[model samples]
Target: MLPSDPAAVELVTCGKIEIEGRLVDASNATLFCGISAEGVDAKCVYKPVSGERALWDFPDGTLAGREVASYLLSEAAGLHLVPPTVYRDGPFGPGMVQLWVDTKDGDDLVDVVAPRDVPAGWRRVLRAMDRFGDPAVLTHSDHPDVCLLAALDIVLNNADRKGGHVLHGTDGRVYGVDHGICLHAEPKLRTVLWGWVGERLPDEAVEALRTLRTAVRGPLGSALAEHLTRAELRALQRRLTDLLADPVFPTPSADWRAIPWPAF
Candidate 1:
């Protein structure tokens, strides 16, 4: 089981580590696997600020903090989609560290996106071309976990929600990761999980948002204040209020691209 207290997880992440290797698939950011000395003995992902590539849109050295912020929001909102993450000084300077999730089958959303035949019970959102110009059908499960992820992405203003970031755990839970580009002050939400666009928000999701609305004014807000700029915090609050008021899935914005490049 994952550690329940955020402080405990932070301690584990900040302790000494033995670098396992680098994860090359993490484009624009360097990711490392390491074994911690905090006694958890679990493998963790270490993303150092110095290794992050400068992006024209996002400020440099802030991606690591954004990763931690996403975890904080997920915890406060009771979404439990993002894995536990902490920001601390690592071997390579300050960075974010998170426990690596052990997926059940190593399966990702990419599998369902272009299956030979559509999976039974899955909802197809749209028909599109894959990166190779081949035909593909974008889809997602009608499961509650998927819905919660969609709602969380909206609040986060996630600019990248690629299919590879979605994971299925052995515990029968769904997880979303790679949140370094989220929570921008600007309206930069981009995602592939739009299967429920324009649909009414589920009761569970609305209640979660209500809980988040309260947490943001209390402990959650204070914690995030250290990581995000004031303007970004205000934007998050505005998004929460808007979500609570309307409680409907949003459609793609005409002004901005709605999906990330190489959708998977």
Candidate 2:
């Protein structure tokens, strides 16, 4: 599961899933599962649609499909930022199952640090005072992979890109997880990755966007329509077009809260 290769998909899709435990901190029922297939085994997270909580903006029982859609979009763009995810039947019914990505301990891509102690290559996001009235700043690494994730969040219209959702994989890749509130028609892009606002996107991200533009027009668009509405699909196309025309990280919008509360 750590490497999350193409075989992981087959394992997650056809493997027998055993509920190992539950991730208690998740808002919904997120099960830690052990999957076995033809003598192969791996770990994954299973989120049953029946456990999804209703949201005022997002429809009920749609979060699981949205998670799968996010993974598909990431793969279509050649971003590979999201771990292999699939929507299939589980013990509790249909839901999203994603490969478990093992992280590198003590390695964090985003953090809230003392203003004076901000790392040399990190980018400052917000300057504010902590609960103790001590000065601090929200910061994230300036690594190219981190920057690419920021762009991916923009396209996803991801409403919950919490710092904890960004993982430093042991495979030396930056992975983003927990994308249930994405692919909405509205412009609700809240995230902690606002460090690169107003800057030009990395060359690789631009190429990814170009590839996505074509993919979204053909088979990808048809596939996503099964999970998303027509309006949402149109909005996705427009967002892609806009980004390709002007490839820059956008600043926070005033219409919505730009940062998710309890960011970590």
Candidate 3:
């Protein structure tokens, strides 16, 4: 279970953790379990700068900061889709430390549904072949949380939003993770949450975007300015303005790849 108090959780995250083990499936992550002075025990995912692989598009050693920035954006927008994340000096150097979400039955929304058996409310984006030549369908949850997630991704310029990045928390919330590849200055919105593309934005969603637009110039902007380049931050602000003005989900563009590889 996660700590009820955000402060307690933050304190635990800032404190030292006993490295449980490295998650082999994770390209760049470490698992740690720790207890704070206040006796708050927590598990966290730690992404060390040293473990990060250099990417052609993104600057080296900046992925950890991007993770923290994603969390900040989620909090500022009142989406709360991302788990609590912070950047601090760790044993391996400066990196991102995020509260580990205890998933329900280890089943994410993506894992529970079969392409052919997609529920009435969900929408399938495309059909493709899996590694073994099996048929597969890419889909997204049609729930409001997913709509907010897509909007958040647009604002962050997220380039790698694979299905596995969306998790169902034991606390009865949906959480998005692995935002190290987000916040690029260029257009790089890729995700499975395009089910509502071209649909008119709901009133609540419009209001949320507007709120984010105002916040970006204040504390939100100041906080992100530290992690992202001026160009990147400006791009984010522009996205907010565009979304607020259009108030519609955008269709996939032919100019860039719309989905990440290994969709699930």
Q: Which candidate leads the pack in TM-score?
A: 2
Screening candidate 3 with a backbone cut-off below 3 angstroms (N, C-alpha, C), the clashing residue pairs are none
Each prediction's TM-score against the native?
A: 0.91, 0.98, 0.92
lDDT of 3 by residue, 1-264 (tens): 462346744664567766777777777765565534556567777788889988899999999999989988888777788988888877677788887777877455653344677766777787777677777777767767777787788888888888888887776678899999999998988887777888988776788788888998898899898899999998888898998889888898888999887575
How does candidate 3 score on lDDT? 0.79
lDDT of 2 by residue, 156-248 (tens): 999999999999998899999999999899999999999999999899999998999899999999989878999999999899999989999
RMSD of 1: 2.3
Q: In model 1, where do residues sit more than 4 Å from their true spots? A: 1-11, 110-116, 130-134
lDDT of 1: 0.82
- Over the stretch 1-264, how does candidate 1's per-residue lDDT look in tens digits? 453435547654666766788888787546566555546566678888989989998988899899999999998887788888888877788888887777766455544456566677776767877779878888767777888898999999999998888877766778888999999999998888888889999998899899999999998899998889999999999999999999999999999988887677
**Model 2 bad stretches (over 4 Å):** none
**C-alpha root-mean-square deviation, each candidate:** 2.3, 1.0, 2.0
Question: Which ten-residue region of model 3 has the weakest summed lDDT?
Answer: 1-10
- Which is the winner by lDDT between candidate 1 and candidate 2? 2
TM-score, structure 2 vs. true: 0.98
